[model samples]
Target chain A: MAFNILIVDDSKTIRSVIKKTLEIAEIPVGELYEAENGQAGLAVLQENWIDIVFADINMPVMTGIEMIEKMNADNLLEKTPVIIVSTEGSQTRVEELIKKGVRAFIRKPISPETLRNVVNEVMGDYDEGGN
Target chain B: MKEETKDIVYKVCCDVFEHLAFMFGEVLDEDDITSVADTFIKASMSFKGEQQSGIVAIVVPEELSVNLAYEILGLEKSEQIDPDGPEDAVKEVLNTICGRLLPAIFGDSPIFDLTPPETTVISYQEWEELVQGHAYISLEIENNPVLITTSL
Candidate 1:
């Protein structure tokens, strides 16, 4: 089965890389959408049924954290899992993201194996590697 | 002058280079570290945290930049690579690298402040002139030199 996916990042390069990595990993995707910031990501959510959203933490116009908080407040983020894709490496920050109901967090420059593992697990595959 | 700052700078450069190489699958080696070339792709980003405003600069050779553009765009190198279009790419690499480095150096949440990356095409002499007062470290990525200059 294929799933709809949204990628939100301010960097075109990183978005391209993530898309490429997904393709290389052979993740089943029905649609691939991109947004440059949190607001844009929210706009996409209004129109599409996204199974997973990959977002960066910092950006102009809107940030990932703000986006998540807004989505939660508006009740638009229920059931839809968001995974923070950022370079931030702090336990407290990651905990904050977890408290905000993020499904998972992946650091930048993620390997294909890890990327695959995250998506698979979120889709309820329950991969042992992800654990 | 602090050990924390020194460690962060070194790690940032190493991490940024490794990330680029991994993403592009291209070979980046440092050929020369002393002087930059006449043609290069330069990116800059401002860091704002705890009453301090500093800048980070990453400069790569034009050849490498063009190559990276092609790799990024997922097009053949024979295709015309738009030099202007990759400015955002430059900025992004700088932003991520700096964002990660700040906390390591400052031992804080890196403040809620940072600027979008600004990039420009620069000449060797121009870069030399710009580095006069600021502290800098240069790396030879697969023989292609990348100079990182910072003003704190």
Candidate 2:
């Protein structure tokens, strides 16, 4: 089955880059979505069946951490996985994020291989042709 | 800024430019610096931690900003570029640089909160003023001058 993915970042360039990277990595995707901030991300999550979310920590309206907190509070939303794709480098901050229920952490300047690996690790194996 | 800190910032800037933008960068000696451009795109962000709080900024030529956006987006030069693409690209670059830089300077354990990067267009006069007023590092990327400044 194809996975539905949502990307949350304030930078339009970053959102495009992530979308392109996902295509380059050949991840089986269905109904890819984009949001400018965590609030918008939550709105998307509320309206759609997103398999995973890739979000940035620092944003204008709402932060990834805040979004995760809200998700954790919701019984249904907490089940969907979230992976942080940011430039954040502090191990302590990363540990805190993981404890807050983040599924994975991906540093900026992401590569296709890293995206592919993380998706496989989080979503389990899926056929390239969407079998 | 201390010489050691300058060196670290310089190294991190070069690495980020290379990895994030696929652009090669080299530190330019003071004597090697030449003329300033007519305009530049300046991107800046602030970071605060328990032991340290400061701002990191990068200034790039407007022409180079377009190239940066294209390079980062992996777009063909012939394709039409979005008007917001250049500014957004630089902001993201500055954001990533700050994220990597804080840890390099303050160690990985200290948590630093980074503000969302901001960008502005400035004239050559303003660029010269910034260079003269602050201790800034100059880099040569794609044969264009890029400046990095920090205030702690």
Query: Which prediction has the highest lDDT against the true structure?
Result: 2
User: Candidate 1 residues A1-131, lDDT tens each?
Assistant: 78789999888777877898888888988999999999999999999988889999878899999999888887656658888888775567788888998889998766689899998777773233242
Evaluated against the true structure, the overall lDDT of model 2 is: 0.90
Each model's lDDT: 0.73, 0.90
Query: How big is the RMSD of model 1?
Result: 4.6
lDDT of 1: 0.73
Candidate No. with top TM-score: 2
CAPRI classification of candidate 2 = high
Candidate 2, position A109, lDDT: 96
Model 2 chain B weakest 10-residue run by lDDT: B28-37
DockQ of candidate 2 is 0.87
* lDDT at B106, model 2: 81
Listed in order, the DockQ scores are 0.30, 0.87
TM-score of chain B of each: 0.74, 0.94
Clashing pairs in 2: none
